[model samples]
Target: MAEIRLENVVKRFGTVTAVDHGTLTIEDQEFVVLVGPSGCGKSTILRLIAGLEEMTEGYIYIGDQIVNYVEPKDRDIAMVFQNYALYPHMNVYMNMAFGLKLRRFSAEEMDRRVHEAAAILGIDELLDRKPRQLSGGQSQRVAMGRAIVRKPKAFLFDEPLSNLDAKLRVSMRGEIRNLHDRLKTTTVYVTHDQVEAMTLADRVVVINQGVIQQVGAPLEVYDHPINTFVAGFIGSPAMNFIDCRVVQDGPNILLDGESFQFPLSATKDGMQIFSHLLGKEVILGLRPEDIEDREFVKDQKEGIIKATVNMVEPMGANVHLRVASGMHHIIACVSPKTRAKAGENIDLVCDLSKVHLFDKETEKVISKSPITG
Candidate 1:
């Protein structure tokens, strides 16, 4: 395993900038995932690191070697593509052994590595099956197995599970994570799926419009996004953003969203960070889970806000309520037992401690709940 580093990397496609000057370090044996929407340069960045596509500027280092001019085959990196890039005519055994054969490995060495990788991937029984006869997931495993036999310094994956069914994607996700834990190989993965990034990464790199937005562990980035784009991008159902006016009544600081207002009872540090904007426009961000059913919350530190239910979507574990509080339309994830009906008004307890404040002008996060939560 080896650490991978990219320094001021830039990749341009003639008139379009595919990847701006982006720098990142992936520690040895760590699994880092690059995630963003399509055309956001995630795949381009991954290809740059793999030397599949040359960077227009900057340098890529694998371990102690600068690989900017290194050929992909000599870069000591193995890549697993979205399409599994397997040999259609070769059986699993031959395909997995092909790389070793090209590199002039002894017959015993090739057989040992092939069987070991197949056993590790639980694909021992399918060694004789041709790629044409394999399922999507099996084909993907064989693709990964091909990389494993090489035992390269690092493994690069480009949305390897995209072609699989949802259930298969989830199952493959665990298998990949488990493989990482066991092999401790340095891995750089690229995907547009936030769920996959959250589940399979040691650190997630959020890239958008060819720029790096934020880098952190899954929950760290989720709980405290650095900007509006990341706030709206990281989570499922997404965080709700309502433009509100800050009104101070006596000792309480309240946000008046033309339709409804929620009290801001921030901790001492939180207050110090946001108290100056008491009378200005600020964007209030609250996760769906942060808005709870009034009946379930015993302690209501935050005042309840009434909203007219616009839609009710029942997900298995929780119910999603789309409600309008005056001109602001937002979603609240509440208990499945919530009896709130469409067109009816209901009170939702906005947990002030869970609130996030962002500057209206800069669009950068101003403050967020303490990490203890």
Candidate 2:
């Protein structure tokens, strides 16, 4: 219902900083997700905006009002916590109505709000059941139902799906997104789960060690990560990082790896960035999905690198291969019928267009694909 903005926000505990000079604006009716590893200050940012934790320095604005010193209740935000926080003694109906009742709404009004919320969440039949009688998914629905009835300025969810089983988590995730679509409520969700962040958010804010790494649409960040940390952390199997020294053979920029030497493509802008770094060390990053079985490769002879498979994990749709090339270990995802067995030398084709280059010292991605221009 309202936009949330944090400008130059700083939250510190003694000598350690949890969030450093953070500035971000969540547009009205937009669903934004704060995603990072644990202890990376994402939850702190949420609490800071929720007025649960006072900012050590800087200002927080809910809508146009500067709420830096406002109380949590006065901020008019609803938070769905990880633990669900449902009172065991109260049935689903009572739990959903508690907030409205406290605000002194009439019985008829409470009935309207509670029933509307329960219908929205598809928990109308479970309204008479206590928390003890419900499943994990049902309990979470009750928690969400409670927040829906309040109709707060914005919704903040802090790993609310952590308690559910994997299958239920997937189902609940869809349910929550659908609910957001219908309500059009401004929502800020925090999660360490990159998959959840990728699937649920309109925009993802990546944080690490009290610093903002990148902020963009999930696929945008995944396709063109700003740094090695963002590149590795955002993907499921994690991007493969190989240490190599940059090589310059006249006009061509080359990467000389452990057992492979390949010329960088010229499809990217600013070749001057790599031209000066020849002979300097850099990290070559490739996603597992980009490496495929050589036999199925389009350009088999062009960018194939040979490595010995160490192990193979047979996932239903694809097989994951752990391969060793000289001293470096890399994982590759290939078809289940790859025919590449453990200890066998296999020709793995690298999709050059999907490869990444990172500065060894700063660890920032040089480009999405090998830069040519």
RMSD in angstroms, all models?
2.0, 1.8
C-alpha lDDT of all candidate models, in order: 0.88, 0.90
Winner by TM-score: 2
lDDT of 1 by residue, 276-302 (tens): 877889898988888977877857645
Residue 205 of model 2 has an lDDT of: 97
Per-residue accuracy of model 2 over 1-373 as CA lDDT, tens digit each: 3999989999999988999999999999999999999899999999998998988989999999999878998998999999988999999999999999998989999999999999999999999999999999999999999999999999999999999999999999999999999999999999999999999999999999999889999999999999999999999899999998888766677788959877774433335656767788989999999889897875555567789999999998999999999888999999888898898999898887788889999998766666332
Residue 15 lDDT (model 2):
88
Candidate 2 Cα lDDT to native: 0.90
TM-score computed on alpha carbons, candidate 1: 0.95
